[model samples]
Target: MANSFSGADMSLRTDKAVQRGPALQFTVDDQLVDAFSGESVAAALFAVGRRELRQSPRDSAPRGMFCMMGSCQECLVWVGQRQVPACQVPVAAGLAVQTLSFRRQHLD
Candidate 1:
């Protein structure tokens, strides 16, 4: 089978050409991750290799960011009591994020 995704490195690049805001820290699934200002939660997670954002509700299959836009809804995560798309929310210091599967596994 041919490689479905053939392209340059799409992961977050930290070259000097790219300007970023001050460094900040946030928690994903209770694990602290480093992020830069003005970065979306999905970007931050992807940078650190936390790609699996949530599991499929019907089959429990792994899911990650697809469109990187809010319309896809593949990167949904929990922030406090509210469940929001990771691609839509900007990373804030001390912010707590949890995967749906994380909560489900712990709560069960």
Candidate 2:
């Protein structure tokens, strides 16, 4: 089998680029969050101590980033009009993300 480097060199606060300068700003579920360059959305959220990214669609069980790679499908989140895996999306200034909790709140 071939090798996959999907998340081989990523960490919440270890990326050199991230440590070199100012962090970018973004919103998670309408709450402000900070993200550094070279950090994925998952890493950014995790940096701020956010573990549960979303919940199961069927049972509402808390879900988070299990496979920093893109195989687990556990980090699903909403960005604008589209649903995306948080682990696969890189962080950028002004980016907006909404987790499953947002949907749950509205359902109540």
Candidate with best TM-score: 1
- Return the lDDT, model 2, position 66: 93
TM-score (C-alpha) between model 2 and the true structure: 0.75
RMSD of 1: 7.5
Cα shift from native, residue 65, model 1 (Å): 0.3
How well is each residue in 1-108 modelled by candidate 1, as lDDT tens digits? 232211232245566789988878778767777778899999877876667988787998999998998999999988888989999999999998888988888754
Q: Which pairs in model 1 have colliding backbones?
A: none
Predicted structure 1, TM vs. truth: 0.84
Off by more than 4 A, model 2? 1-21
| Residue pairs with backbone atoms closer than 3 Å in model 2 (clashes) | none
With candidate 2 superimposed using the best TM-score fit, by how many Å does residue 97's alpha carbon deviate from the native? 0.3
TM-score, every prediction:
0.84, 0.75
